[model samples]
Target: MSRLIKNLFALIPAFTYRRSHLAPPVQEPLLANNAADSTVILGAGIIGLSTAYSLSEMSKQTIYIVDPASKACVGASGQCEGAIGDFGVENELSPLNQLSYELYQQLAEQQSGKETFGYSGMDVHALSSHGFNSSDPHLPWPVQEPEDISNLPAWLKVPRGWVAGLIANQTHCARLDPPKFCRFLQKECESRGVRFLFNTTALSAATDASRRTLTGIKVLNKGSKKAMNIPCKNIVISAGSWSEKVFSTLFPSSRLRIPSTEQQPAQDWIRLKIKKPRRSEAGTKGSCQQIWLSADSEDLDIHMSSFLDGEFYAAGGFVDLSDIPDTPDKVTSPSHVTDIIEQNTREFLALGLGETVQAVGSGRALLPRLTTNLPIMAKAAWDDLFPSKTKLQEHSSPIAARPVGDDSDVAGGVFVSTGHYLDGFALGPASGKVVSELITGQSPSVDLSNFGFPKADEESGDSRDN
Candidate 1:
C-alpha cells in the first residue's frame, strides 16, 4: 500500500478513540433566492456566517448569503490557527475582540462547541528560531521563555537553540477548527432559515433613487451566468479580502474605495492541516497552544496551533504582498512560500508521530490587511455605494431618506463589514452580532463609529483600489 494509506491505517486506532464523527458536510449545490428575504450577506466566511446567525436570532428574517466560491471560508477563515484571543488586538477592535471571546463561550454552550468544534482554552507561546531573520510577531512584546521547556505542550518539540515563551493574554480562548465552527454556525443559520447561494457573484445594488435606499442586489450565478435581483431591505459586505473588489464592482461609478488608499500591503500564506495526536494522560495537554515561530529578525514568518479535535493547523509562509486574486477561489500558494513553510510542517508532523497523528489537508489564504489590522463596519454614503450594514440614523448620508422598511426618519441600506485582516475568526461572532443589531434598527452592541467607509464625497481625490 502507499505511504499515505499506511499512515492512515496506523492512525485508525487513535482516530477511533479520539476523533468524533463530524456531521455530514453542509451542501449548497443548488442556487435559490427569495424576493421577500430582507437581507443579502456577501461572503460566507466567519463574518458572513456570524452575521446571518445573529440576524436570524434577532430579527428572524430570511437572510440570503452570496459567495463567489463553491464553499464557504475558502480564504483566511479556512487557513487560520483558530486562536481566538487578543492576538492582533487593535484599539478599534478591542471591544469586539473581548465581546467575541465571551460570545464564543456562550455559543460553545449553546452549540456544544466544546465537544463539537473542539473548543478549549489555548495557551499562547512565542518561539525564537535561528533559521530566519526575526521571530517575534508581537513586536516589542518581549520573549519570556527561560531555559525551561517544561511549560510547553508535550507534543511541541522545538529545535536545540529555540526557546518558547508565554504570552499573558487573559482571554479564555480555545481550539476552534475554522471549518467545524463555520459549519456549526452555518447549520444554526440554516435552522434559522438562512439561505446560502454558493458559486454566486453579487454584481451590484438596486437602489431607489427617489428614496436613496437599497431595494435589492443584482447577483449572478457563476455556473450559468443567470442573474437575479435579490430584493432586500439591507445588505452587508462581509466579503473579507475581496471587499475592495466587491465595493468597486458594486459601485463602478463611485469615488469610494476600500482601504481608501492602501495603508498597508497584504500578505500571502499557506496552511498545513494535519491529524493531531490524541490528548495525553501525561497531563501536558493543559491547553492547546498557539505557537509563534519567529527568527531573530525576519519581518514575519509563521504561526501554528494543535487542537483537541485531533487536528493540527499551522500557517506561516511569507512577508510580502501580491495581487489579490479575482476571487478567493483563485488563491493558490506560491511554490517558494510553500517550500519555506513545508519544512516546519514536516517537523511538526514528525513530532506527532509518537501519537500516530498524520497529515489530513493543506491550503492557502491571502492575509488582506491595513496599517490598523481592523475590520471596516460602516454605512455607504447614499450617492455612491450600497449602505449595506449600518443603522439608519447614525450613518445616513446627506441624500438619505426612508429605507425599504420605511423607518420613517432614516435612509440608506448598504453596510460595509470587511477588512478583518487576521482576526476574522476571533472577532467574527461579535461582528455578526453588532451588524445584526445595526441592520435591524437596534443600537449596535459595540461601537463601530471608528470603522467603515468615509462618505463618498469625503473619499474623493485620493481613492485607489487595494
Candidate 2:
C-alpha cells in the first residue's frame, strides 16, 4: 500500500509558486499562524524548511520562511535525484547525520501513507572492476562470489556476510521525490502554523545596536518590486550556498588572517568565502563522469527493489564543471545538466549498460569545504564578529569563547551545520535538530563532541576527517 501511494504521489507536482499578492488557496489548517516569537529563515530549501517545521512544532514560534524562488526547495535540494544514504563516510558519523536520518524516517512515515514522496529503500552494491560482461554485455554485471565480500571495506561490510547475489544493505536508506518531499514539508509546516513567504528575496538584515542582535530583514516582493521589513526576534540564516553572501553582508570584514609560521613566513588575510570547487584534477578530469549498476534482491530488500521495478537498477552519475560558477550561490547552468546526461550516457555504454534509464535523474550540489576537505562546523570567532560591534564591545572575543578542542560546548546561539555535499538529504534532519537544541539551550539529544568540526588557530594545522 505504501508503495502504491508512493507511485501515486510521484504524479503530484512538487511545488507551485503563488505570487506575493496572491494568497495560497484557502485551506483552514494552512492559514493558522500561531508563531509569535518570529524566526526569520533565509532560504526555503530542504534544510531551511525542515528547521522551520521543527522550530514551529517545538516552540510554536512565528516562523517565517522566505525565498526568492517561486517555491521552496527550488534550488539545489529541488534538483536532487533522491539518493539518501550515509555511505558510512567518516564525516557522516556525526550526530547531525544520525538525526537527519531519523527525521527523514519520521517524515516518511507521515507522507508515505496517502501522500507518497517516493519514500522507498535501496541497496548499495559494490563491483570490484569497472567492467564485467555477463549475459547482457551491455551491462556491467556484478561478480557473484562469497569471497568478493573481502574486497569491501570493513565499514561497508554487511552484517551477516556478502554473497554472490548481494553485498550489503542499508535498511533505512531511501529514494525520495525531492520536490514532492519539499512540498510535503511545506504543507506540514503550514499545518503547524509556520508562515511561508514565497517570491520574497531577503535583501539584507538590519541589526539593533542596543540589543546587539539582528532586528529584522529587508525583503523585496519580486512581482511588484515592493520592499517590506519583516521584524523578528531571531534570524536563522539557513541559506545553502548563499549563506556566505548573507554572512558577508552581515559581517563584511570577516576574514581569517593568519601569520605565516617558520615553514612559510608570510602574512595574508584569507576572505571567508563559500565556493563549490569542481571535483576534477588535471589527469582525472572526466574519468568518473557517469555510473550505472544493479544489485540483487538480497542486496536490496523487496521493499527497496520496488523503487527500480522490483529489480535493483541505479544510474546517472556524471561530473561536470561547465554549469558551476566561480561565484557562489548561483544556480547551476542547464548546460551542465546537458553535459551530465551526455557523459552519463557515455558511462552507461562504457559500463555495458544499454541505455540510460528514464527513471534516473541527475542534479548537482555544492558542499562547504575547509582546505583539508573536512568541514568547518564551529561558531564564528569573536575576532570575526561584526567590525562595529566588536570594536567598542567589552565582551570576550568569539575566539576565546570557541570550544576548547572540537567539544560541542561552544558559544551560544550561533552554530554551523554545512558540509554534507552530496549527502545532505541523508543527514539534514538531525543536523537541524542539533541546531534547535543549541538554540533552546538544552543538552543535544545525541553526543557530537568527537566528530564535530573545531575552531583552529593560525599555528594549528588543517584537520582531515579521514
Candidate 3:
C-alpha cells in the first residue's frame, strides 16, 4: 500500500502537465442582439456568470451580462487560490458549500472529455497548535502523525509540538484554476444564448414610473462613448463589493440597508518555480513535492499550495486596505508587494525549503468582507405605504412606508446576491442556483434565511432579537 501511494504521487506532475495543456472546447457565437428582453446581470465575476448559467439552463430568457472590466473574473475571483471545500466554514454555510460541490461534480461530468475547469481532488493538511483528536466529528478525515517531522519538506514550518490533521482524501474538498473555471463558465453561459457586454459599465437601473419595479438599466459602452438602455424584466446584482453602489443607483432613496462591505487588507502572493534537479540528486533536499499547507498561529494564518507544474503559490501578510489601490492598475508601490513575498519566503525557508522566486505580485483590488460574514441574497422592496399603482406624475414622488425589512409587504423585482466575500468561488454555483429559483418563483432548494438581507431591526443597529 505504501509503495502504491508513492507511485501515485509520482504520477501527479505528469497528469497535471497534460491537463494544463488541454484546451477548453470552442465557444459558440455570442447572441449579442438579445438585450431588449433579457435579464441583465451586473458584474461578470463567478457569481454573475454562475447565475447566468443557472438562469439559462432553467429559463429561455436571454441573459445579458454587463461588466466594466475587459473580461469576467478580473477582480477577486481571478486572484483567488481556487480552493473550494467546507473545511472551517460556519455550520450555517455548510449546506450551500455542499450543494456547490455537487453542482461542480455535475458540471465536470457533463464535460467528461474536456479539461474540467481545473477541478481536482486534493489532500489537505491543517497544522494546529492544539493536539489532534482523531475522533473529532467535524474532521471528515482521520488524524495521523506526520511521516517525518524531523525531515519534513523544507517548505513547511511548524512548531515542534504542533499537531497535523490530515483531511480524508475522499472528502469533498477540491481545488481548481480559478481563471480557467471562470472562462469555462462564461463559455457555457454563452453557448446557452447568454450575451456578454464586456468593457461596458452599468451606470444605473431604470425603474417603472412608481419606482416599484425595475424595468431596465442604462449602460455606458467604454469602447464607444455611446450609451444605451437595456430593458429587462428582472435585475440581479452580484457585483461583490460594488453591489451597494449598483443597487443605490436605482433606489437611492430606499433605505434598503446592506451591512457595510469593506475591502479586506491587502496581502502579498508569490509564485516560485522549482527547478528540476539532476538524476543523481533526485530524492535530495531540493526535490519538488506537492504540498498543501494551512497553518494558523497566534499572529498569522498561512495557506500555501504547490502545483504540478513546478510552481508554488504562497500568500501572506496583511496591510491596511487603505494602503492598496482601489483599481488593479493603480498599485503605486510594487516594493511593498515584493516585501510581502520576501516575508513569506523567509517563513518557508525556516522550514528548510529551497525556493527560487519566479514572480512576485499583489492583488490590486482588495477583497470585500462583510461584517455579518454571511452573503446577502434577497429581493428589494418598495415602501409598503406607497400606492402600488401611482400615476406617472407621482413616479418621482417619495412615499412613506416602513423601512425595508423581511416582514415589509413591499415587493420589488430586483434581487441581490453578494457578500460571499472570500468564499465566492466555493458558494458561487449554489448561490446562482438559489437566486435562479427565486427569480423563477420556485422554492429554494435550501433554507436561505441566514443569507438573506438583514432584517429591519438588525439594519437599524438594534440586535434585541439576537
How much lDDT does each candidate structure score?
A: 0.61, 0.44, 0.57
| Better-scoring candidate (lDDT), 2 or 3 | 3
Q: Name the lDDT value of residue 123 in candidate 2.
A: 42
Candidate topping TM-score: 1
Q: Please report the TM-score between candidate 2 and the true structure.
A: 0.62
Regions of model 2 farther than 4 Å from truth: 1-36, 85-87, 110-115, 127-167, 170-172, 255-363, 366-383, 394-416, 447-466
Better-scoring candidate (TM-score), 1 or 3: 1
**How far does residue 459 in candidate 1 sit from its true spot (Å)?**
8.2
Model 1 global lDDT (CA atoms, 0 to 1): 0.61
- Count of steric clashes across candidates, in order: 16, 12, 3
lDDT of 3 by residue, 1-466 (tens): 1111110110000011112222323323444444335688887777898899998988888788877655566665655556665454445777787788788777867875125565655555555555556554223234555544544444466666666655434254556666577778887887887878766777776655443555677888778887888777678888776676677765566656566534443444555544433123211233333233334442334446644333555555444453333223233235566566556554554322343454533343334445675678776654421233343334445542423332233233678888665467777888899998887778888888877777655543311111
**Range of the 10 consecutive residues with the lowest summed lDDT in candidate 2:** 264-273
Residue 394 error, candidate 2, Å: 4.2
lDDT of each residue in 300-326, candidate 1, tens digit only: 455666666545555553344455566
Off by over 4 Å in 1: 1-37, 86-90, 129-140, 144-147, 169-172, 260-283, 297-300, 348-358, 370-373, 384-412, 455-466
Cα error, residue 204 of model 1, in Å, equals 3.1
